[model samples]
Target: MEENATDGLPLAGVTVVELCHSVAGPYAGSILADLGADVIKVEAPGTGDYARDWGPPFAHGTSTLFHVLNHNKRGLALDLRDRVTCERLLGFILDHADVVLQNMRPGAIDKLGLGAAALRARKPALITCDLGAYGRSGPLKDRPGYDPLMQAHGGIMSVTGIEGGEPVRVGVSIVDQGAGMWAAMGILAALNKRHVTGQGSHVSTSLFETAIAWMSPHIGGYLSGGAMRRPLGSGVTEIVPHQAFPTSDGYIMVAAGNDNLFRALCGAIGHDFAADARFATNSNRVENRRTLIPLLEDIFRVHASAEWQSRLDAAGVPAAPIENVAQVLASPQTAALGILQQAPDLDLTLAGLPLEFDGVRPRYRHSAPALGQHNDLLSEPIAPEKAAS
Candidate 1:
């Protein structure tokens, strides 16, 4: 198949070498690849990225997680522990790469002699991104990191789930993906700098730091202002009428961010009690949430979710029926937005990038490669004279 014209893709000429495993590092590489970077993912010699095994819902017996995070990239396996092979691989990447991404435990890359200092020495303009569980300088720098553990440690668990239930990890690998996005942003920023100064610098982020940054609003509220947040279970703690309420057919989420919207919500539902002097203000509504919510639920329960949605929309108040993943995927809005696409000749579908440029969006140009699928590319003979040169 012909490569589509990449007229609007931002990183068309960039090349990235991803020596990483699992979601975080590879995810960043995938984003860059989506934006038109040539991302070559270096995997382990045999087992490959560990995410390859993290699935029950596999496509062609490959991990869905791996496929989702690794599209539009090539894979080459190398035995980084083998000094000669490692050196050769590094040499190849240093010769042409613009970015190097790795998620090894703190000292692993250094041990393999591909540390940032060494790579920088070889190619001064090559950006190096090091992602880890805890960053490079802290006491826990050497410790291995994973998303779930970081969620627990970074207080994400504290703000999730029902108030009386067990502290719950997010249903997704949010910490890992957050770290990936942060790392990507840093890499792009460094790239911008490199364009001006012709120098590359180390970019580092950790799962813990990512989670903490994601939780900053709640953390700041609790730590600096003495405002504690409780797990309200699908509800915003300080916002009344922002929780999922039962409708005749199903649950519907409603948000009333201000007085007019609250009034519109009350008017739309024909609930005069919502406008009572006792519940007139947002603060009062929040204070009396136990009373207001049940009343709203009672009113909402009299109508189907669809009816409530129409009524709320007509009132210019924001509302929607609560939807599961299947429902969300099947939503007309999702289809209209072209949020999902299928890979050619593959039984898999994946999300497209959220933004468009010059009326063009990123397309999935290739399926995720199988383990060591591009071994020839890595293992091809380089004559000794070429190697010496």
Candidate 2:
């Protein structure tokens, strides 16, 4: 396709009807929107998306989190149960929408006659994605789920946090966002399939499934007769000397991932660990981690993190100082990447889609729409007979 044909954007001609709220479904819609799709976000008539009120840290009179998840789209507000409203939405989908991304409570969209099977029956080329709680077929599929709940239920919590400490949820909504990315990827693949088959497909994903996927490596080890994995704080079971150690001032993470790097690291620290049989190879290091780590820790504490970073760099060992969010945002690397973007029409700066095409990152066209901001699109609703015709 010509670049001018899509305004230099990949999905410029596609239309997405986003019946989503909170995180997962909206996040998927936002990904498509960033790629230049015409996304219309539908919400409840009076209250809008529940995420709109999710914080005291409001921006433009709504939660910042909502803005982050919902920018670059139009918004429509309607009561889906109303006969006329349902008909109007269905008409819009049949005529204009290429994808329907929804995460309504289990059975709700089906009860409203807007499920994938029903919509595909009307327009076989219409793709639909279902972002659900548990999954579509398990015994607990009907139950509502949140990110933390899935983390706990799907065994992620079992392998997180300090080994003997209380359970800790991952600091971010990893499961929800992962599920959203998966849903978006599935839809993209389905769209490709439609180009040849002239038929749509149902793309389904859930937070619980995403959580389980995050535990894949650990699961593999356990199935291979290894003991159940325990949390190692900042450490991983497979690699030694790969965790953070405290320096005189702060912490620095060192990763001596291979035997050569480990030998280099020992030489940099003026240690003879490479000459010791118990620390000669990666396998030996793993077996002797309980003894070796403390010795490295004592050596690291003699100098500051920066000095250690410089020494490790000179020796060609991978090491870095731990940084928080503020430090990360202020770093030169973050500015150079151009991931932070400003909306063209709003006083909002947000992280853009983490991708580039032909040396150009997707630009933010506009901020998130106000509730019902595009209701005029449905002002002249298509009559049932007229729509069918």
Find the candidate with the highest TM-score and give its number.
Answer: 2
lDDT of each: 0.83, 0.89
lDDT of 1 at 358: 76
lDDT of 2 at 275: 97
lDDT of 2 at 24: 91
Give, for candidate 1, the lowest lDDT window spanning 10 residues. Answer: 380-389
Expressed as tens digits, the lDDT of each residue in 1-389 for candidate 1 is 23442335898778788989989999999888888887888999778889999987888889888889998887788888888889878877777788999998778889998888999998899999999899878788789989999998988888899888998998989999899999999999999999999999899999989988988888877887756877788887667778888888888899898887898887898877654877898889888888888777788899888888889999999987777899899999999988697876477899987877777678877778877766666566421111100
TM-score of each: 0.93, 0.94
| Candidate 2 local lDDT, residue 208 | 90
Tell me model 1's lDDT, rounded to 2 decimals.
0.83
